[model samples]
Target: MTGLSAAAGLGRTSALAVACARDLARHAAEHPGLFPARPFDAGFFHSLGLVGAFGSPWATAGELRAVNRAALWVFAVDLQVDHVAKSREEVAALVGDCLAVAAGDAPRGPLTQCLASLRDDLGADPRWRDQLERMLAAMLKEWDWRESGATPGLEEYLRNADSCGSAFVNLSHWLATGDQWTLANLDLVRAADDEVQRYLRLLNDLTTYDREARWGDANALTLGAGRAEVTERMARHARTAAELIDPLRETSPRTALYLERQVGFNTGFYGVSDYWGEL
Candidate 1:
């Protein structure tokens, strides 16, 4: 592409990111408890928006709504499970409430209310609930490990990577804006997303080990995996993710590109900064 075209593309992405940030701030304002100011500050909204806008630059702010909201919801859930909940019962209650909302029950609180809004917005996709449950279960498992001071094996920690929430965000994106081919081939795409999610999980662990340690959160490094080990695992998963994504280009090119951008964007973005604000 010419330099002018490249500059135009950048301009479009910046504009989309700004629009997404506006929408996200509105949502956060509606559910203040779920997005407290300390962590979910202005930078968080801006960064989350950029993730969506850049991950699928072809998409508009409206088209990116589900993914953006889904990503925000993941952070809210993480904050509750990792920081707010004082006891196992409290965490379990939060999980139950969220699942109930997903299952069509009335939302009982800010977290569930936000989840319910997302569910209704995504229309009818059973996979949304399935992916959501996987994320929630992974989070609960991590909470249990933390509470019991359990150090799960690296493989096991990697297996429970739904707690990273990327796959859930991907599913929401696909459900909201994917073409027919992409929708039909979701299982194959999800396999690719799962691989990417694991890579992202390790990527997060690599950068956030100090914060994780300070926050008493579970991480691969905290579980005794060396940085070399984690980096090696990230490389392996990234390769597998590519292999899984390769077949989709012919049938679901946008879906393929979306996944590719996720890996590419985070590889660079996480190297410099993360999406969260100070604690």
Candidate 2:
């Protein structure tokens, strides 16, 4: 991540993102039969402050586009996992095609195309390739659990959450901006950043608990924890994330702030959406 100075606002970056969002909208429109009804238009990425977030050290227009494309691509695949896959067999087939595309197999569908584009943009980075593979695997594990009606423990859920594409998307920006330091030290970066992912998981669990209950999907808060207990757990992760960010600041302030911004993004969206049941 590169363009972060303390003073810059997200306006210019958001303009770029607005254009990207429109492009995604058009893509979804064009691929009517292939993607979700709302795909990528849900303001998920937009609300992330994508334009200015993530140390955006973009040096060229093409570079920025590449990053944006990869960002869109990841979200597009996630939308598939969340809304489309209906069974273990279906998920296996979907993951197989996407994995093949990511591994240089022929692109088979819109989602696979997105994976292919991201793979091309990444250009032989085995670390990110490994990361993406792990993310997809984690998604499958969660889906399998959901399908089997098995509620996971907090630790099990957290383990899967770390690789459930949330953290992978954030860390992908490091590669997008060609940050050598981040690429070289991803494990360390993820270690310091783990609590941020946990925060996201809990907040997502809280916000979507009702929806998941209605859908009969797996959720952390519903897995043997009362609302009060879940709320307290969310607080613990948030506080721990703040402490984690302090050490991260010493290593890379932009990345540190980026993590905090995600927390901000999640909380603000949660408030507005009444994901906490305040409404």
Candidate 3:
């Protein structure tokens, strides 16, 4: 009962959606090649439904924008690294630009600019800078794997996938909710990764396997898994996630509720959308 309504969360932030639309529209007009029309366009961004996924009942308008902006930046990095950039050098350079900006240099491109904007707007916390580094390193691992044309072991794939920055963004919601928690201690993130995030990564593969294969990228399913095997793996993770959720219920019920809400949001979001698929 303590969980916030995902739909209601978006509803309360209707103005954020409008602002995003206008801002993206203007950026597309101004940036041309950099902000290209496909992914950065209003229609596609609206289809992402990020407002609901990242929106928290307890966040102020400014806090909501900060977390939501951070979440979008994470996805942009994934798209550029996963589907766009062809060479390892290209990926490495982009990562370097972002890290440099996070480290206080001026940004060089759209991706780095996005990182700089968020870090500046959010107070340039070194923890946020660390997350930028963490996400880029994990994303670079995929390029290394693809460049080698080797199949990653299940353990290895899941480990890198968790580094997708979902957990970091999830943790950021603490700050969004009146600084209830901070990203100061990353040690405890293992608890979130243990179940809630395990379920998310597995489900992401289950839903995006075909699309990922088309792009020649790694997914949880790309490791010799058929649809049945992938679905089964998701189910197993769900059970483990449930077990982890129980302890949270008694201790930090609020954090537990947030996890539960995220699991539900991811389930419904990926269930209906084929945005990542090729066909």
- Per lDDT, the best of the predicted structures is 1
Q: Which structure among the candidates has the greatest TM-score?
A: 1
User: lDDT-based ranking, best first?
Assistant: 1, 2, 3
Window of ten residues with lowest summed lDDT in model 1: 122-131
lDDT of 2: 0.64
Residue 65, candidate 2: how far off, in angstroms?
4.5
For residues 3-105, could you state the per-residue lDDT of candidate 2 as single tens digits? 6743354555556555555555565565656544443334644543243333353233344555455555655665567667766788788878877776788
Q: What's the lDDT for residue 102 in model 1? A: 92
Local distance difference test, each candidate: 0.92, 0.64, 0.64
* Candidate 3 structure quality by residue, lDDT tens digits, 1-279: 335676666566565555554544454465455555555655555533354334344444444555565666676677788767878988998888888887889988777777777777667667666766777898898788778877877767766764567765664555445323324333453465456666777777777666777867667677665677666766787777667666655545666666677778678878877433131
Best of the two (2, 3) by TM-score: 2
Q: Give me the runs in candidate 1 sitting further than 4 Å from their true place.
A: none
Put the candidates in TM-score order, highest first: 1, 2, 3
